[model samples]
Target: MSNVYIDQFPAEAKVIRAAFYSSFLALALGGVFGIIQTLHRTDFLRFMDSVDYYTVLTAHGVFLVISFTIFFLVGIFTWAVTTSLDRGLEDIRFTWGWYSLMAIGITMTGVAILAGFTDAIDMSASVLFTFYAPLQAHPLFYLGLVLFVVGTWVAGVDWFRSWWAWKAENPDERIPLPTFMVLTTMLMWYIATLGVAAAILLFLLPWSLGLIETVNPLLTRTLFWFFGHPVVYFWLMPAYMMWYVMLPKFSGGKLFSDPLARVVFVLFLILSVPTGIHHQYLDPGIAEGFKFIAMTNTMFLLLPSLLTAFTVVASMEHGARQRGGEGYFGWLKALPWRDPVFTGMALAGLMFAAAGFSGMINAGMNINYLVHNTFWVVGHFHLTVGTAVALTFMAVTYWFLPQVTGKALWSRSVALGQVVVWFVGMTFMSNAMHRAGLLGVPRRTAEPQYEGFEFQAAVGSIGELDAQIALGGVLLTISLGMFFANVVGTALNGRSDDLPANEYAGALSGPDDAPLVLDNLKLWTAIAVVLVIFAYTFPLLSIIDRGGLFGPEVIPFPLTVESATTLGFALETAASTSFESAGEIATSALTAVMR
Candidate 1:
């Protein structure tokens, strides 16, 4: 009798399966766009006009990061909450509702972005992922984002509701580790998203609809970063959850310490939102003092990451040792390297360590100025969200698919090769991106090469860098193909009665060993809120004070002929009115002199 998740909670499994498929669809679209942009930027191939690059870039980012990552994590969180609580959701209908909302919302947003490629739609949102002001998108874009965020908010509420019901049933028990992670992450996300929500709902949406004439660019940017930086953790925490809970089991051991994992998540909740300004060190409107404070907070964030590394590595080592492996380093060989689930996550973690070192350079205000908007920043995130979050998700899918479908994985060999191929491809691509950035290569452009000015590389020529990027992009595309093949092949396979029971790693040092204070959700949520207030209140006030709620005369970019003509007429009218007022003042002065 296999006690798998689908057997225990058949209703919930259906929703999770739906979420996973939705995410896979987005991944397919995003991956296609990713290759398109990569090949185009490298000048290896150019199917579309250079002007349409931003549209492709926008689609790639929003689909993968927003739709793909978030949809998948929400599913994982659902599984985690239900599995760890040992109970089903309060209502399956509610679960389906949030998923549907997310699907519809992302579809609308995706349509708005893709419409940019066609002249027939009369609508476009080529504003890129940041959707930064001055580069305004169509109103549907902002509206869709609103719906998407609201769906996530509802999803968080559903998780809380489950926890609340479970707490009522078991009054004296501490929160489960997976549930703790989910709650803390949701709390951080709730806080972090407020910035973007405010930006879109209050300002960007109104402006896009022509209800507001202008918006403070600095203010919108400040608001975006507030959400932007913390959103990194929002993506990462799930991957971290998988590492802490699943990795050790796959490694053939129990978790090292339950308390340590709880503390790391708590720290992430409290510190993540306040550190977003580290991204804005080069922006002018923000004072040096505030940027410095953000930099300080960002540095503090490293502590949690370091703790995670220590605890996870320790857990893996313990697992390796328990498998009858003797010696210090030799035990590493005892790990299940043949398992795609294990190797993919292991490689993802190794790449994330490298990301952390590069991230340090990005977090430091002084050093960040050198690569603020350069290709280096791109490479840094490609490692974090791109590999760390993405690779972990793909790797885990090999394990997760079978559990949900009641079927054996179609091909472990292909799964193994897929993960390795992704790792190698990213290495080549991200390495070249970092090197090129150091040589003053700009990012987010159709063409990197200028007519008169050539970027002089310190080591390799620019052509070689381009070649590496193109080769890497090709390899990554191939990896995506293999991944999809496995997914499709698995879905086609017949159900198997023989499957491993669904379970996370047990902890050697259980929750009983940890202090009760670690599970105080209210206390931590309060502290996280307070930290955000302290970090943002003054800087936000200063920005609004300097640049009015709506900024001084600024025009939107990628303007249509109609909008351009209107802007020209408005400018001419203003100039004429000013000149007439000046003449009247001069005439009054002359009359006074004659008298």
Candidate 2:
């Protein structure tokens, strides 16, 4: 029998393959919108008026971040849990149930967003991914997100239960490293999602349905970001999983430090949630002390990624050395450069190193003034989430697809070419975006240039920068095409009777070298929750005390001047109602005195 995943565990392989396909569908959709956006914004092309830009932007963010990312996570985490435990899922029916629920949620949310382009639908939600409240989206949008979040929660539970079952059979063995990573990440996920749950269920959903008249913008924003920052970590940890478990093996060596890897995940679980306030440093309503705490935590959070860089690089170096390579950096040339999996992941990590410096500037409370909401911010995240997570996922597909299908790779050369194209394309686009941002280019705008100011570059004209951006987008779009073609072709034609068995590289240092405390997930979960309460309690209270949960409401700003001016006029009137009420009472008292 073939030692591939499909031969060893066919049912689990099917589930994983299904989830991956769903994720790829989202990627394809997101890529279409991504190209359209880059072209339209750069004035390279225009298929729709500027009014529709927000709609497209909303789709791109939601589809890629929520759908593409989480679905891949579900698949990969499922694979990790199953492969590490050496067991099939406890119940195939329950497994399929969660997948179905996720599909429905994504469909519902996507429909609500796509509706924005048409006048035919009475419902539309162009509110963008932040979904900043007081800027209402259709109720279905929130409803859809609610289902999605719940589905993921259940999926996490499924993993936990599987782990529990494994323990009963081998009660003395420490939890496997891959299984430990999944459990800890899921624990953090449950803690992180509470903020968004409260935001949608209690606030945005009701307000959108007209059950409530107004919402506190600060509170909603705080809640959104409470979920937001931690969510970034959630996206990243799976990519980290591949780095720790899969990458060294692909490089032809073992993982360097098992114990340090556990510590890195534990640090993320504790640090990720408490640091959300750094995102709000520029907003006036929040106090500075809170911002300082968040900034401190944010800086501390950098330790793990730095540790990761050192560990991953060291592990790869070991691989090269094992292959009879020598010297400080000369061993880098001995790596499996032709392997798409290794190259894609290595380049993604390289981009992440660049992203880290920019992210530090964003996290620093004082320095935030320089890059907040600028293309610099966008560029920073694209390098991290866009490349680090995304490229890693794409690269993983190159290795993982074959395991489930019992297939030889379609063309190693084609896969290598695709990853290189992605790296080169993103370098052009992200570098231009970073430079444009330093020049104060506002992001999320249909047209970046304004008549009042001319954007002069140190090295080139603004027009030239736009050309670079457009060219990069074109290249990225082409890369996506090549990737899709390779994957689809492999899926169809990649069967081989001689496929190798599924395996991860063993660590040079084993889990026995690590302290047992690392496996104490219950204790870690408790600490994570405590940190979250400490981080959010006062900030949330201040928002609610200054404004009630529902009111002392502020009108949402119109996205465009051409939007209903009448709505703004009405908001101005309603906002002055308290003053009018006080004046009416004073006038009545004065009239009585005269009498």
Candidate 3:
């Protein structure tokens, strides 16, 4: 048996594997919670109770959204950055320390949720995972949040340290394309999270502990969204990197433009950070002008997303066309549909980006009125984050499973079937959710009721979608279980082998055909930052009204502004429908907060 030690490939790969397992295991747990929670709420199952539902919700949010996505991204970035640098991981101790801290943090948070202490601090905020103001959970939740963030930060530092040391050892060098992209992302993450982290640790934590008289809820919300929005990209960047750098090779072609990928990363880093105020479109405390600016800026972040979409598609198309595929759709047919890495990334990317197109509406000042906090938001994110982002993780896992454990997957067909079912189920389910939102079905409520027949009909239709989604979820969950079993079994029982050499490798710099503009991130990053500054400046400044951050008793801002004043503003707050009684859509906002 070939002995592929932990450091055989870069320690980064091991870290990536560790991260993958961590996220995957956590996600499996989250999925179990989600399935149970969804079923209990819908009456699809009668076994669970309110306490179980809430606990599952807490676990799902904390683990799936908070833990899985971030941890997976960290590991992938580590692999990409170190591999690009052609070096082993720079600091083994730091890597292990970061991993251990994250594991401890996640475990602590999970245990805390199970112990029923979440509502101790502020019972009202226990309003399902988003933890919006007026409702409060125990201080343990906030502490858990802090610990998770710290764990992530430690990992982020390790990433930076490795890349920096590599650069220092080779002074006169341009950063490798993949490593450069990751570094810029982490830099943006550091800058972006600072506000929310401060708001949480200094304000929310203390307030929850009864250590402070009150926290500025409005300010906290604003800061939270600011970090919240860009965090999606933080989860997504490695997937993008893998798509640009590795997918093409797996499909038998070179990356079309190394530098263009760099530009996209840098652009996302800067523009994605400050445009979070778009989430506050429905809130009153923020000024109209500030909201307008943030809305405008949100549109700008789409450019980089579009650019990446185009670049990755082009690369994939080129690979397809090269493989004896001819005309338009022919290239699609020629794609390596059987290869886990290539097909999985391509399908996931397309669907996620397609779903993300709705972001334009969500970001728009007028359109958001139609569907904010409704199933539309739910549908959009499931496609983008749930489908697209999660699929990437799956693809990477499948691609590298053998290398990490030195065994073939238990069943390739099972893996492929899982991907297909997920795509199909997500499409139908999200579409129904969007339709339900049009029917004014609010999110976060256990059930929805309406007076009109049309509304009832819509609700009836939603049942079908929900059923389909439940089925899809079941299939996906089963697939995940099989995957975990395969990996574990392989690790334990499979013969050992040397980890494969880096297969889809790219050079630090592109060939002579590379465009000059693609090589530099500074310009794109600057443009993105400027765009964000323009977006968030006014909104943030608007928070300091005289009375305090809340409203009326605190400030001169009108409690009721004319709809005309809202001009491009989307949703009408005055006529907002509430679910005071059971069986109607819940009014609380679900934080699309997780990246």
TM-score of each: 0.94, 0.94, 0.85
Q: How accurate is candidate 2 locally (lDDT)?
A: 0.89
Model 1 lDDT, full chain set: 0.93
Ranking by TM-score: 2, 1, 3
What is the C-alpha lDDT profile of model 2 across 358-471, one tens digit per residue? 998898887889889898888888899889999999998988889877777787888888889889888989988988898889999988878888987788878888888888
Q: Write the candidate numbers in order of decreasing lDDT.
A: 1, 2, 3
Give the runs in model 2 whose Cα sits over 4 Å from its true position: 554-595
Among all windows of ten consecutive residues in candidate 2, which has the lowest summed lDDT?
A: 555-564
Error of 2 at 129 (Å): 1.1
- Put down candidate 3 lDDT per residue, 202-229, tens digits, no spaces: 7667766777666566777787888888
Q: Is candidate 1 or candidate 3 better by TM-score?
A: 1
Native-to-model Cα distance after best TM-score fit, residue 570 in candidate 3, in Å: 28
Q: Could you give candidate 1's per-residue lDDT for residues 186-211 as a string of tens digits?
A: 99999999999999988999999999
Report the Cα lDDT for residue 52, model 1: 86
